[model samples]
Target: MVRSILSSSTENVLEKALGASALRHKIISNNIANVNTPEFKRSSVLFEERLAEALNETKATPARTNPRHLAGHNGGGDFNPVIVTETTTSIRADGNNVDIDAEMASLAKNNIYYNAVAKELSRYFSNLKAAINEGRR
Candidate 1:
């Protein structure tokens, strides 16, 4: 059914990744903007490790109470990204942790990651659309 397909693990993972990437982009941009501000701490989004752990969680097979019961999928739920500020170290005398060079590099990396996830989501939806249209033709 449409609901099942929309809630598929692949779709959920891609959606979460896109959202996390966007958040990371914003955080990185903020760091860049605060590069000259004193006592500004750089923040980063934590997602990949948590996502991997969620995906690798063990699934318990549900006990079937009826002969006609539908099988349940053990696909993990959507993951939320955590944003943490780096407060342990400061590379400058002003106690600011934002490094322009590092922020720029992170920005570029996040952009690439976002683009890749977006492209994959586009491809997924395109395939779904093609399937829907196939019966019409």
Candidate 2:
């Protein structure tokens, strides 16, 4: 009962996204740190595509009238960010594929994305708080 008030599926999904963003931030920072190392293939976290696919799944499920009955597939409930190493390309002579320019660009974009998601999450809780307080007045 308390879980229903504190969060919904949307909130859960946003929290997962924030977690993915934090992980992506760490991975990107690691790549940037190893920019000068030899043959250091840059790594990136892939989350959005998989998350979207999970959320967009349209598989059919049997309807149950009872609360104890079996539940259907949960969208975005099992999604996780995947870390991928770029191993096919090397621009420098040392065979290192860590591109400082591209990484920096990605960092900026990710910062904005993270901030946006955080703001939205904050807004959700703020609305909930407002509603709770309004009931007392």
Candidate 3:
């Protein structure tokens, strides 16, 4: 029972994270594509820490005693992630700050992490199916 619950929760978080990561990847790709364009400052996604903090806050909060109580003030499961930020560092002489090499590296790492999360989600579903079909085993 506990495993199933935890798996479901993890799957939810992974799904959200993957969505955010994919958005980041797209933005990064766009930045790289527009590296030659004039006045492109290279926006980036900034949600990993926020997402983790939101999840942690949700976990730390006690369950509400009232059914109609507003949720998510603390651990209320607000999963909406932000995906836009300006770099603190300066840009190139051409006013384009996106480092293609760095963005590509980040994309590769994010892809690997996304794949792992997907595999874990699949395993979780498969385990649930196995448990449900135990009678046939």
For residue 23, model 2's alpha carbon misses the true position, in angstroms, by 1.0
> What is the Cα-based lDDT of residue 130 in candidate 1?
94
Local accuracy of candidate 2 as per-residue lDDT tens digits, 1-137: 89976768779888988999999999999999999999899999999988878877624445578999988765556778999999999989999999899999999999999999999999999998999999999
By TM-score, is 2 or 3 better?
A: 2
lDDT of 3 by residue, 99-129 (tens): 8788888888878877887788788778878
Top TM-score: which candidate number?
2
Q: Which ten residues in a row have the lowest lDDT in candidate 2?
A: 55-64
User: By lDDT, is 2 or 3 better?
Assistant: 2
Clashing pairs in 3: 58-75, 72-76
* Predicted structure 3, TM vs. truth: 0.77
| Backbone clash pairs in model 3 (N, Cα, C under 3 Å; residues 3+ apart or in different chains), count | 2
Best by lDDT: 2
**TM-scores of the models, in the order given:** 0.83, 0.86, 0.77
lDDT of 1: 0.87
